[model samples]
Target chain A: MNAPQRIVVDPVTRIEGHLRIEAETDASGKITRASSAGTMVRGIEIILRGRDPRDAWAFAQRICGVCTLVHGMASIRSVEDALHRAIPSYSIPRNAEIIRNLMIGAQYVHDHVMHFYHLHALDWVDVVSALKADPKATSSLAQSISNYSKSSPGYFADVQKKVKTFVEQGQLGIFANAYWGHPAYKLPPEANLMAVAHYLEALAWQRDVVKLHAIFGGKNPHPNFVVGGTPSAISVHSSSGAAKARGGQDGTAVNMVGLQTVQTVIKQMKDFVDQVYIPDLLAIASFYKDWGAIGSSGGNYLSFGDMPEKDIWTPDSFLIPRGVILDGDISKVHPINMDDDNEIQEFVSHAWYKYKDGDDKGLHPWKGETEFNYTGPKPPYEQLDVDQKYSWLKSPRWKGKPMEVGPLARALIMYATGNKQMKELVDYTLKTLDVPVAALFSTLGRTAARGLESKVIADAMQGMFDSLIANIKAGDVKTFNEQYWDPASWPKSMKGVGLMEAPRGGLSHWMVIEDGRIDNYQAIVPSTWNAGPRDTAGNSGPYEASLQHNHVLHDPKQPLEILRTIHSYDPCLACAVHVTDPEGEELIQVKVK
Target chain B: MSLEDIRVVVDAGESSPYQADALSGNAPVLLRELAEHVRQLMAAGEPTAIDLNALPLTPADLDWLKATLGEGEISVTLHSDGESTLAETACPGVWWVTHHNESGHVVSRFIEVAFVPELVKAHPEDVKTGLEYLESLIFDLS
Candidate 1:
């Protein structure tokens, strides 16, 4: 019998941050085992020590450019949670709550659209093949799928020309390094062209849609998030006359123009998702239906829950309820307690870092430590020493078990807990593809769930906006509560966890405040939960576990199948480790020694 | 004063006639230039690149530009030796391209009016070597 061979994909592209995957496969090309490693040490937690808790959001938001606002939201929520603990009488206003929901909802929609088209679509799409498609046929095919306004033959012809020019010029720019014409690619030429066209559409669509965040939170990337409430003030009266007198600078308020722009952006989001994103996903999923069996991570799912109804502290008020589903059993959901020391813990046994107590012992985020321990081989070496410390990411465990997080977990939990909308969406998608409920547990299912949830969140944004407008009509225009902004009002010693369902998955920022300054701050981000290394119990993380089973590699050099599985998780190594080397070199150094 | 009179005063403050007209004026002249560039690309298939850094753009002007041009079909981030991003505007042929240094700072920004940005194209030299490498691999495997 032939020995198993190893295939390594260093610096996995299209995702938010740096990641490397090493898989050992039999001669038959089926993966037997896999190791997921976050190659960079993010020492943001270490740098955060002794800083004012109020300013932590600004620093923490810089963790990842892709998931910019989520970290800021989590950071501010952590400070607010601590403040609320200090002042039990403190509460965020309804207006503030509504605005935060809009911001979060916008992030989910924007991130999901960007992820599907810009990042993950190429894994399925063949850009070179799109050039071969008949523009008229592509237009007809696009129109047959949805009522998207951009489905003119002339429009498609222009897009085809643009793509053709790129191909003829022998420059595939972003389309470079693609596994074009690979056996795994199954989309018809016309379908590929339609997807390619929408892929271009989504890029433009996202820029406009994200302006909602800028209107409400100041800027798109790493928007301003105040601890008590949003930074935006609702302007009931026009500052136009005043602005003109002081030179045409727009006022810092949610005026009629701002409100209308938000409305326009929301409509645009709905139109694009309904017309372009969802249809493109379904169309693409139809082609890659076989991927439904590829990447299943034991069906254990976890969600910290996000988008609160009344207060963030109250778990029952969450839009996506917090719970745990173990072993793919949807009938029963175990309640998640973020405060319990036994509920959530990070293990560094398989990771490079060492804990204060022991390398094998798991520590809760409240007592989490970020100690850099590079015990692996030096740079420019080959395969990782997987038997020892491999990744920079600490293995995070819920109840001593590795669980998958993100859209799949959220969708499964929502479906199991009898969320009507989620059930309808999942049922419709599965029925359309003629796949079973079990199919929702694989890589394609994970990607599909992301698309489905974007629609759910985008539709929900209207309700949130309406509620905000209703509040304004009732003369409740206040956006910030200044009661807890002062440091003197905070408790001398306090620790609190700010939990939210970021676009990727469940994210939490745990902070210990001493004299109103952060003593020890640790952020257990979503990507860490999904992409961390194996735990003390030797349980592989979601990324590693998902790559197991029948993920067969046709070509070891291309490794397109591996990319499909990893990109489905939308790995964001930037959120896990906040530090990059001075040279900003490749995170994964693949050596074949 | 009557309650109706008080309501009227408040309404007057909130709604300004000049403000409504001035909002339209906020649109930048670059939008016209960008449109012309797109027309050029469509007619002649000749790529036109505009350096946005050279243009005097205020924050308001930038916002207007974003709104006016809108985002088009594709946005790409290329990480070779350094990071560069190219995004197409709603105008099919117009594109926004930015080059970043190693530290993730934008060194130069351009609005390239073409079917696709030049930076996204594969270098001819690299393609030549890539083809050779592929042929060699095929030969070795066979």
Candidate 2:
């Protein structure tokens, strides 16, 4: 039957970095299960094992060019927690927290805006449809939206011209490989025109917001963070050495004038997150009414809450307390237990690690064993099917369960907690978009909720920033604590897991120090949780479970719909591997070992 | 006065015979010499702080530098009219000096460095890289 129709989509278009999807269907094309395979596995874990604990944070951040700071925060905080280290006081002022929140808010805006317009837009907006849209109507409509105009005359006209140029030149950004003009690629021509125009605008603005990271953490993608404390140098001296860790004060904050300019920039960027970003999300959600029924995955959710106390940077007193929701039930919040944090274990069985049957199952660092000898990659699943068992990724189970991550998990946790602002914004959004009250539980809800959270986070950040400025003006700004304790001075054994709610979801580092070196240093990153393969019992990873039963239309060649559903999860498969044939060809296969 | 320091302990398993070859790549000779110096210093209290301002860093130090500092710049080059206007290197304020055998070795033990919190605050990004570099250097290469 035409060689069992195989579709291999390598270098998945319109996402940061690279990924490939290979799926196969049976004869008469009814369809069997599919294997989501990953082509790249550049040994980030093994490389991290022997490095300095602090350096691990920076290196880990590089694992994904997109989720950089999240990794950095997770890694650093993990080490600090393991060592029972704490930063100084006078660093956790409202301004300090606000500044941190602002940076994070900026990143969220940049990532979400980029995700909506650049990556996923093509799935719904046919680029070719822009030519048919009345430019005059587009401009008038754009003008009507107070947030969408350019002061420059004929500027809207120029943006439209650029969209036309992009379409004509076929420069689809990294979206070069995405399905731009395929059927099932829904959305009206006008919608496509509007989205395409915004895609171009967001690209430029995303850069401006990214600079926010540079101002604070010191770079985009991976920024320098303050763990166990705030970042910035001495607010007291505002000079050499004193103002080292602090981003402001010292020469770091020397620009009183620049602060005003920076604030203006942040406000402008904030306008997009509040006005354009959220509205765009709500607008898009309106058309995909059925997403609620299709996109939900797993019953277990986790959050190692972030944002510390108003005047404290102690790991003990984190902002978002670590808690897990079992079976969609948010009845009571339990503290994150590293020992009891079962349900999550990586089965190197299908991955490139030598372990007992490839299920490299272990609790975490403190309680974990130090047997890191390597053999080769093994098929984690017990049942063997050579055709699909050669990938380097392991199937990790959370509480022996498949847990979903990303903004959805964060949104759910926030939603369950009665976050008044989040609830208000989401509730209003649902009404404005004409979605069912319950649609807040679906995929589109996740997409919109993440954008809405950006606003809440931005507003919160402004508070943190101002407080920090006041602290600086009050003559206090030391965020670094350089205390080194002797390994022999105390505990020979301490097993602790450092937790944080990374932008992607839960991020943790399990560390064990014996005789002073990292006797066992293992990290369960967000990507690892999101993109794992099947466990021995054969439960799918979070994204895999979400993709189950997505009705594949007539031709499998046009998969932009399924891709949009999955990309919404923002799979950082770089850290997690998937099943693939040794031939390195396609993604369609049920033959998993 | 509170003592300000950040300890970076590296794994020095390369001395294990099974991994002699891989451990001593372009580094063995230099590390051996540094190890000898560390072995001598072990009897004294281990000084984990290394002032970069006072460094003519040896090969072992270089390895430690790359590991700990990562791929970020140590200095910002402010330019005027497209020309280098100011080039001030970060002091990296504080440092760590790792003595081998947990400060027990007398001859074969070696030492590497990382950033102390003070220096880390100065070049915050490098603090992490430096710590990582120490982790890599002090690891049991075997």
Candidate 3:
């Protein structure tokens, strides 16, 4: 019997923030155990304390640059929810809801596309092999997959030349420090070349589509978020000749030109997702069929449904349904009782946080503490003490179960709970790949689910836009409900949970507003659920379980397989930490007696 | 009603403490990279360019960098996508190039360590096309 070799990947690149993964592989190179550690900490919740509840979104929005708009949306939704619960008339306009949908839906499509092409695609596609590809064959291969119009032989040749020039330059830039020639990369030269071209195209595509956010929210990457409704105002002058005099309506307001731009961007987004993204996803996924059976998270899934038609209070109107699926049972979907303390709780037994009562006790977000207790080995160390506090992320469990969140969870809930469009899309993916329904539980399935949902959300964005237009046409241009704007109409103390299906996964911001100020604010992000360490019950997180399931590192030195499974979750570790900087003084100085 | 009138600023004392200076402690690191790039160009005679847009350089850092490198004799403007300026730094073989989109937004910026920046030079295919055009003009004259 041979001893299991431990492989550690500290500071995983191409992710939003710092994440370290340590896996132990057996004699046959199959991973037996894995630990995920979120290395950075930011005291966002503590900073939000004593701040105006309405202004908390601006601060919370800085959680992650990649997940830019989600935290802002959630924070505003928390405020809105708290105020609405207090006052019956605290509701946003229909146009506001539609606009919010459009914004978040765009986020889903944009984030998923960027994640696929820029982040996860490199795990499967070999760039160095792409240099040897025949441009003509690559064009044919691309044309056969999708009519993206950029599939001309000359176009591929030019791209190939550009890449050749870049490689010749000797500075690979972001493409450096990657496991380029690793055996885990399975795509052929032509496929790799096609994918490489789309990678660059997606970068440009994302830059243009994110302008939709800027149009509505006033900027991309931490877009402006208002409490009751969208921040942008609708221009009445657009219908009359006054708009032209005002330079085609105010740039700050949503006018005909801005709407036209939104429509064009949506069309471009839908076309690219339909033509390039999905087709490329299918083409590349067909080659890596074995990943269909690998990286399963014990078949537990959760999705706090998003893209609401009305508001967060009503779950029935959500495009992505909220439910919990335990032990791979698609037939039985359990409703999420968010208010119940035991239903959704965070434990820090194996994490770097301390609960006043005990580390093993799970506390609801309403009573969640942000106390930091570093009990593991210091930084610049070789390994983590997996048995002790090894991570900054507190393990968030739904009903005492380690449930996987994000695209795969949402996809499964949608399929199980019967979302027509999502069902057809998931079925189509399975049928095209010739894999079974169980394949939807693996790393490849997780990646495919992201593309499928992106298409659904992109298509849904058109409906949201049309609804907004119709509302505006019907002489309702009210973008904000200022009835709740005055904090004087607020209750003395109130708490609310803002749940949304962030592009990454189920994200919820729990806020306790006391006397018009934020008493406590805690955001339980998707990555915390996916990348958290072992809980008190000793249940490994989604990342750890997936790595231990069927992951076998061909070369432990080049752990490309580990990256594929982890990147599948689109891990944003910066969103997970709720503590202050370890080196700096405590942001709030919570006394631990 | 004007954009300039809407002012909202949060003063965090002399320094924000949260926002790190782009080149404060890392000027030497970037200078070291530039030096290595320059060294490679000198020893191997291989040209290289650093994408300034890719780096986290603040506006002040950019000004400081420009001041450190200073200006050279050559400065060329090319109207392609929109407008591009390729200027040589005081240090020979170091060029500062900035490219803008059609809307005049700075799309890409780079620091090129080359005798002539790549964007300023005509491609071999374009040169061939230029010769063909010249031949056509001669034929018309004849």
DockQ of 2: 0.01
Candidate 2: regions farther than 4 A off: A1-6, A24-32, A85-102, A143-146, A151-153, A169-177, A226-231, A234-250, A253-258, A310-321, A330-335, A341-343, A357-390, A485-495, A577-593, B1-142
For model 3, how does the per-residue alpha-carbon lDDT over B19-76 read when each residue is reduced to its tens digit? 2443455444677888898999989999998888887765546656776788999999
Chain B TM-score (model 1 vs. true structure): 0.74
Residue A579 in candidate 2 has what lDDT? 21
TM-score of each: 0.80, 0.69, 0.82
Interface Cα root-mean-square deviation for all models:
10.2, 17.1, 15.8
Question: What lDDT does each candidate get?
Answer: 0.82, 0.55, 0.85
TM-score of model 2's chain A, to 2 decimals?
Answer: 0.83
Better of 2 and 3 by lDDT: 3
- Ranked candidates, highest DockQ first: 1, 3, 2
Candidate 3 per-residue lDDT, tens place, A1-593, comes to: 34579999987877899999999999988999999999888778878888898898899899988989999989998998887777756787788888888888888889999999988888999999999999999999998988888999999999999999999999999888788888778888999999999999999889889889989988888899888888888763433322343334433447655777788889999999999999999999999999999999889999999888877788899899999999999999999888899999999999877777998989999888767777767456888889888998999999889989999999999999888999999989899999999999999999999999989888888878877766766667788888868777789998887888899899999999899888888899999999999999999999999999999888888999999999999989899886522333542454423
- The DockQ of each candidate is 0.06, 0.01, 0.02
What is the C-alpha local distance difference test score of candidate 1?
Answer: 0.82
What TM-score does structure 2 among the candidates reach?
0.69
Residues B1-142 of candidate 1: C-alpha lDDT, one tens digit per residue: 1111111111334654334443444346667877787787888888888787787654345555666677887899989657988888887778878798764446887888888777788899999999999999999999
Which candidate, 1 or 3, would have the higher lDDT against the true structure? 3
CAPRI grade of model 3: incorrect
Q: Name the best candidate (by lDDT).
A: 3
Candidate 1 ranges with C-alpha deviation above 4 Å: A1-3, A238-250, A578-593, B1-142
